[model samples]
Target: MSFTLAIVGRPNVGKSTLFNRLVGKRLALVDDQPGVTRDLREGEARLGDLRFTVIDTAGLEEATDDSLPGRMRRLTERAVDMADICLFLIDARVGVTPSDEVFADILRKRAAHVILAANKAEGAAADAGVLEAYGLGLGEPIRLSAEHGEGLNDLYAQLAPLADEFEARAARDAPETDVEVGEDGDEGALPAFSDKRPLQVAVVGRPNAGKSTLINRILGEDRLLTGPEAGITRDAISIRTAWDGVPMRIFDTAGMRKRAKVQDKVEKLSVADGLRAVKFAEVVVVLLDAAIPFESQDLRIADLAEREGRAVVVAVNKWDVEEHKQEKLRALREAFERLLPQLRGAPLVTVSAKTGRGLDRLHAAILRAHEVWNRRVPTAALNRWLAGMLEQHPPPAPQGRRIKLRYMTQVKTRPPAFVVMCSHPDKMPDSYVRYLVNGLREDFDMPGTPIRLTLRGQGDKNPWKGRRKSQPSALRKHLKKGT
Candidate 1:
């Protein structure tokens, strides 16, 4: 029942800029290039005391069928349809164009409520464009510069009423079902520690990857012994800390090594323990040494997180020592892009865990990725995206028979697992599955979280079916016949 506010506009109109402004962090990639944002990105937005889900959609463009621009437009349209309120952003510096008019028409036909925002409206230069925005017919536009943080009070005032209305509607429509907490006596003396209560986040990586240092910084003390030794920490330790007033129980596990070279019993036990920690953790922060980033072991660990269905955040530690930091960062990003395509947009943060630099950003990224992990896209909107995906690139046929993926539903979250019922589950190729996972990751803005897709054959029959009629006599007769 969360309210969603979608920011929509043509390319280079500062939709991502406004998204970063509302989300209060520069999570979305910003570049001078047009259409840098190919996917729909979402974040939990806060405007003063007003809290809502804000979605940054792909730039709207007019294109012919089967083009990238057309697919991007379809993605934007889907986001607009799912939103309760739409914030239509226009570049006040450049004024409205034909693309803006087309999108405004689309919004007029689809969106229930719309708010016009004139971005880059700083000084007197933007006045004319702000006035020109009225041509869209949405209403008077609120002028602001996302980069400079100008005119936010007006934006807050505009959103407050919509937020209040959404809250009221949600309260009215809320279901009566409530989860009952069992008492200690009734539950046969509940354990003093409930492992499921506080969110468990695991910090894992290779040896000397700053796992121990990061934990020490987070706890603000020498809780775990940190040394120059390769395997200084031998056991997984759990510490309870409140991050930004949110209670979180973090698990710091020993560094993992390659299985073939695990010589000692202690190292084997530690590796097994680390794997178990990954399984238990709701979110896993994979720490990587900036000196040797994205090694084979790193990829293996990330793949393990994906296989285990855990939210992942890749942290590059000791970034301060690197000579060409930006260059190294770009190379690392490219490597991640090429190597781990499954986690297409996984959150990557560069931090100096030694000096406590970028800790705040790392924490924020972990929290944001966790939010995406727990996110659930509505059934209607998911189906809409699925239909668009199919139209864009139809799945390939196997043995002259088309593989029809009929329906998709989110069966579980906390690493968002989905079930896509199809005609032939076995015939579906791995490449096609990767295509769908990438599409879901991009369209749903579920970055940094492992998305699980399970294919179930439509023709598979349940064993429980028709079992009610066959009693003990039928089973005995079948046994006798077999004998």
Candidate 2:
């Protein structure tokens, strides 16, 4: 029932600013620099009482060839075709440039419904520019200031009627359903199938690792702009789809470089955004280049996912071009074990993001990793396993005092965490904790998933806890003696 509104303009015309204002969040990255947004980002927008879907697109460029800017232009044109309305924003401060006129012509032909907005029209300085915007012949330009939050009521007024029309069309096309509502407005007989929330997966790696290309293969469409350019994607773009019959919301994040090498402000923001995506993701696919597998940055990315307690699956991309596949895969497995001992048994899949080979195996690996990450062991089994491990290799006694582990229990899953009630929890060494963690992984078939082991020192119960102690007074003793 909702309509899609795409904001198209030349670079730095306040398109992303207006998008952030409408979405009520900084979903799209904004900067004074042009072309900061390279991919289309979608968000649910709310203005006044009207609601619709808003798309923040890359700046419309004049290039029509296979260059990066040309690819960006093609992607924006696709958005124009998909959107129900196109809100053309022009900089009131810079007035209408030649590029703006060109893009206006394109939108006039491509966009079904077009609304002209002269953004940053805050004061008298923007009045002449606003007047110039009318020469494009789209319509009367709405004088707007996205940064200052002015003229939004006019934007709302312009969109409300279009929203109504879309809703009317949706109602007319909607299929009829005969259903009964029970008390509290609940449906009495719902469908047998229940909707499950899609799994959240994020693909992250160093620059030019084919992260976007892999996701495009999964999506079966050119949903994101991809090229030989190292860092085309600037934001963590998430798309929802069904892959291998499993519903998933997959995030294609910007490539992360080392801290010392990153000097640009926009790249810094991009790296931070990718890190945030990893945190929100339940499963992280660490994509690596087949030609240069297990670089320092790749290891860092995988370790980061592990340290964040996310399910990790290592994938070597661009495998189709490899000549000695078996030798490379063997060396890859060896290096994975030697470098990332923490992620020892994790699934390492060889995939070709370009040719789309080995995707089925990658999907199976991801599901397996997720299952292992969420695997939980019962308390009885855990305690029994702990007893056996302790008997086999007892806890070290520091300074001739023996350490005692009384009980063990799994406190939580999702990178399954456990607690051990013991004596001298602080005295327990990291080596011992690793021992127990490795033991749990092996005994419980929880391979490659990060495990958290916590030791709590158990003390003797204090019977006098929470009770006030009364002392016998000397005066009371003397009175008793006199009596």
Candidate 3:
């Protein structure tokens, strides 16, 4: 296992910012509001030549067992236990508070290696607090500015030795293995990574859509906080596990309500965070209540996922409670086909998040959708299909000149994108593009996934094709001669 480092501190001390800097991506959302990060997020971190797994944890707090802050504290404690070292942060401008002291005591008792950091300590106003951090009893404080990229070298100096020691110990304990060589006898060549990346699925829908309940049913545990409350989930929490041997990462996002109704600042942040999760996900499962299926908001959510170029699976929740199963299923399918024709062939599975009914079907549908999304077609077959499409319903000619399509090729996949070399790209109507896209979907068994068909014309910019160019304007030629 790689060396692990966990960042733990009270709320709004720039812990998330430091996490982003180390991971070189903004995976964790950061804001001025306290308690913004409510879950632990892990990523590979790099500083100079050092590489380790860095986990960004929710800010620690002292609260009773049942409250939200208390739950977050418990989760952060789990992260501390999982790490090889802990970096406890304190805001230099504010100095140490009672909460910081309480957390320090806990980390001292629990963590094997503790590194203290005084953040936001760049200016003269923070001088006193920087000195105050020395009394935390962890060690000498590393005066760091996570946002401005300062004091990382000092922090690296402390981490380098620990990383080296960990590597040495691990190497000594590793089992002996034989190295395989290719026919060319390449020396010391490491084996290629054969394991595929886990498929990332994001579950999203309107408020109280049973998204969390469905995830719990799949995981067979109450890994998420689910209640009758509408907005209990505030952050996009990702859980990694295997579903029947298929490695997967599932994201449970906060329910998204319409913009006009979102008045609270926290809810607004929650919704934006959910949208980011959708963008990052490979397949998005739009869960809906069976009784109120195809609501305007539900349709909008599914449409957003489609537009984002993600594989979509429509899952109807609370199916166990429905009285008329056959009628409800038929009606839901018809409404889905009529309302979201763009995703015609996408999988629609019904499940009861509360009872776990139809979960096997849901799992199969997700795997199938993922497969179609990653499918590719050869260039020769694509051109042959294009010819058949043109023969059946030829493109329109706006000014008595028929548009000629010469070639077609699949440029990329993951919601397959294609480019067709045509006579006039700009003149191709939206209806025609839709016709081609639908044809691709029907002909290639690529239903329900987003398909992109772009028209490109040959580089000949001359407007007058197959016509003799008018002799260079006689007046222009005479003017050039005179000049």
- Which prediction has more favorable TM-score, 2 or 3? 2
The residue-by-residue lDDT of candidate 1 on 1-483, one tens digit each, is 458999998888888888889889765656666776655667879888888889887788888465666656776788898899999999998998888888888899999999999999998889999999999899989998998999889988888888888889889998999888856546655542354577688999998898978987888865565666676555565677776655678877778888888887656766776788789998899999998998999999999988898988989999989999878989999998899877788889999878988989988898788889899989888888899999999988988999998998998888788998889899889989989988998888988688888999888568777666745688799999999
Per-model TM-score versus the true fold:
0.55, 0.93, 0.80
Candidate lDDT scores, in order, read: 0.83, 0.92, 0.90
Error of 2 at 227 (Å): 0.9
- Badly placed stretches (over 4 Å) of model 3 are 179-196, 210-228, 232-241, 249-252, 263-270, 320-323, 352-357, 378-411, 418-436, 455-483
Tell me, by lDDT, which candidate is best.
2
What local lDDT score does residue 61 receive in model 3, on the 0 to 100 scale?
A: 86
lDDT of 2 by residue, 1-483 (tens): 679999999989989899999999887888899999989999889998888899999999899999999999999999999999999999998999998889888888888899999999998999899999999999999989999899999988899999899999999999999998656864666532222577899999999999999999999999999999899899999888889778898999999999999999999999988999999999999999998889999989999999999999999999999999899999999999999999979999999999899999999999999889888888999889999999999999999999999999988988899999999899999999999989988889988999999999888778788789888799999999999
Instruction: Compare the candidates by TM-score and give the number of the best one.
Output: 2
Which wins on lDDT, candidate 2 or candidate 3? 2
lDDT of 1: 0.83
TM-score of 1: 0.55
